[model samples]
Target: MPKQIEDQKKILLRVRKISGQVQAIERALIEQKNCDAILQQICAARGAMNGLMHELLEVHLKDTLVVNQSSEQERSEELQNISKILKSYLK
Candidate 1:
């Protein structure tokens, strides 16, 4: 398969896994599970979300900075956009 398609599939799989984790959290809440267990699940889900974000950011950086042959101005714009996204993400 093409690299892009493969990457997309991997991303989708990660999304599904994260969804499952979220559902598990919901189920735990509904079942009135222990607070510690629920907190652990929330932490797990958060970690998974962070992993997904990191993967997506890496792909975006590679596409914008390394893979594409953009002009200097375009590159500068892309960097600004990435900076804006990172600022928002960190908050």
Candidate 2:
């Protein structure tokens, strides 16, 4: 399989695991589990999400800015797009 497809599969797996962690949090709340356990799960899910975002951003930067063969204008446009995304992401 292509490297991109493999990377997408890995990302999807991470998403699924994060989803499960979120569901567990919901279930814990419904079942009146301890606050510490619920908070720990939330922390884990948040860390996983951050890790996924970092991976995607790195891949996007490399694909758009480093390995791309576009014109200067196109590269500038891509950089502007990335900047916009980062602004919203940071907010």
TM-score of each: 0.92, 0.84
Alpha carbon lDDT at 63, candidate 2: 69
lDDT of 2 by residue, 1-91 (tens): 1137766787788889999999999999999999999999999999999998887777777767787788899989988998998899889
The model with the greatest lDDT is 1
TM-score of 2: 0.84
Name the best candidate (by TM-score). 1
Error of 2 at 55 (Å): 0.5
User: Please, what are the lDDT tens digits per residue for candidate 1 over residues 8-91?
Assistant: 787889899999999999999999999999999999999999999988888777777888889999999989998998999999
RMSD of each candidate relative to the true structure: 2.3, 2.5
Candidate 2, residue 27: how far the Cα is off, in Å = 0.9
